[model samples]
Target: MRRGAKRLLLGLAAALLLSATAAAGYGWMVYRQAERAAARMYEPLAPAEPPLAYAAIPQPTRVIEAGGGLGTAGSGQSESAGRAAEPVSGPFAFASEARAQPSPEEGDPFTVLMMGVDERAHDRGRSDTMIVLGVNPARGSMLMFNIPRDTRTELVGRGTLDKINHAYAFGGVEMAVRTVERFVGERIDYYVKVNMEGFAELIDLLGGVRVDNPFAFDFEGYHYAAGEIELTGEAALMYARMRWDDPRGDLGRNARQRELLQRLLQRLVSLETLGRTGELLDAAGDHVRTNLTFASMRGLALDYGARLRDVQTTELAGRGRTIDGIWYYEVTREERDRVRRLLADQLR
Candidate 1:
């Protein structure tokens, strides 16, 4: 080979090596940053308390049994059937200590309870939005539904029937989780709690998101048209918070919240947003708390994400009633059973 040609080839090789080194270093930095952010966001529940005794608590007058056992006809009654027999006790039952944690790498189906808490200075605040997601990678589908903030149910730790959202205000995440598990009749594999106040900043960090608005409405000085619309951080926050004008009230607002979340998730996993990893991690570190570790999160992104193409959303059906001058959304036992079946089926 000519001397000049040899020099040119060496130069190209050196440049390629330098580029590879730089790429590897950047990838490591991102991974380290994610680990740190996950550490910051990690907030596990305190030691699990023994399952609460439901027989001691007062039962509602109406008793309704679900059609059949939550098991196959030929098979004997399932574990879920035993849990369902004692309506009050079964739902509130603590997650079994022996239950194995589902693995994303193995593509095991799992459930996540997402809570959006409206916290303020010196106040713990309530979980204004509670959404349960059942993800089945094998089925390439996800089932999502919102539990109305005002749905009247027995507050697990408090031992009183009240608005479901009050569980957070009364006992924070642990209590909130237990209450929700009772309400849904399924064990939640994980939870992600986001401070609603800081959620705006996180949305803004992602350069905002686009969502389909069901109808035109003006909220908090922002006018949302009846079609697809782009929202800034503040606009999205208000959009999710407005419930008074919504004909369905909290139910309607819940639907909008679901829409916002679905859109946000879609944006978060997009290539465009991946470029802003540092900013997103910082924002999430401050605003979000979850039991999910960095490794599990990476697995979910790499393994289960592409398979979860279908997203189905539904709301808990209930009616509003006033008790002692206070209004509450009341859900029936049968309806709760139906939700349980839906989630169970999704996991299976």
Candidate 2:
């Protein structure tokens, strides 16, 4: 992972933690505040035109009910049609008829593409961090992995082979999502994008996090002992940013990021943090963007939160290569296919 990649993964971790706050069973006032915050964070991606190569790939078919459950395409009317007949209230308000009528014993399996963008003034920066998560509440498990930012692949909408992260820089979230869907050979059910710069503030608001350092090292004037330790926002930022001193280099830094992420997630979901809903939502509203509606989030929390206890993670294998005097992470066809199958099985 490079500097931008490291920064974005932190943003992803914080965004996920804050998003889970919607399921904490808050009172009406807190729920209303969450609804308002969700409204600010909502930025739906426009429909994308698939690339030529992906024309034959059978994309997954799913109808997202207003209540966030999965239904067949012919199960009911469109969400927009349902909205048109009713007065819009809060973000959670949905017409009763449009709600999903899934089997009581079944659980919806869905995929999410989470991106950390390195946006700056006057530039729609690249997706420095790209991760895919497959959640199956019925199995009480999840599949997750990261796509290296420097990987060379088809840029989808742009019709040229280039670094995968460049899709965001060229066409924003729509193109990024299109490119990734083609890469994984599946349709992404939802997306969450976060600007990396705001991640530190989010960590601070959560009262910091705990990480088990594998080795004792000092970077940017912060000394970390080799054991379980607590870090302030700034210290944690530095902790994830150091790679040169690490013998494993980017790989070591990546592991640290994952460890820190797990810690933050545990802290966010704990009973102790439930009282700080307003502050958490406020921080998230400023830095996060997603297509998930408030109603859907609440439904997921209530329905799937308890069942989703087992988590599994894997890495996409690739090797560094230089092409035309530029460095890129090149993944083989076999490797890509293996990952696609893993995701496909999870969804099934």
Local distance difference test scores for all models: 0.64, 0.67
Q: Positional deviation of 232 in candidate 1, in angstroms?
A: 0.8
By lDDT, the best candidate is 2
Global Cα lDDT for candidate 2: 0.67
On the 0 to 100 scale, the lDDT of residue 189 in model 2 is 66
Per-residue lDDT of 140-247 in model 1, one digit per residue for the tens? Answer: 788988887777777887777778889999999998888887677677777877665455555676687788988999976899999999987677767776778889
State the TM-score for model 1.
Answer: 0.79
The superposed Cα distance between candidate 2 and the true structure at residue 181, in angstroms, equals: 1.3
Predicted structure 1: clash tally: 0
- List, residue by residue over 1-348, the lDDT tens digit for candidate 2: 235334535444443534444534777788778888888888887765433233121112355766998754322333232222111111221121122322312467777788877777898878877878877878877787777778767777676667888999998998888888777666676788877766666677777778899999998788999999988777887888787889977566666766665566557656666766688787778778888767666666567655665767777787665444566666665676688778878876
TM-score of each: 0.79, 0.79
What is the number of backbone collisions in each predicted candidate, taken in the order shown? 0, 0
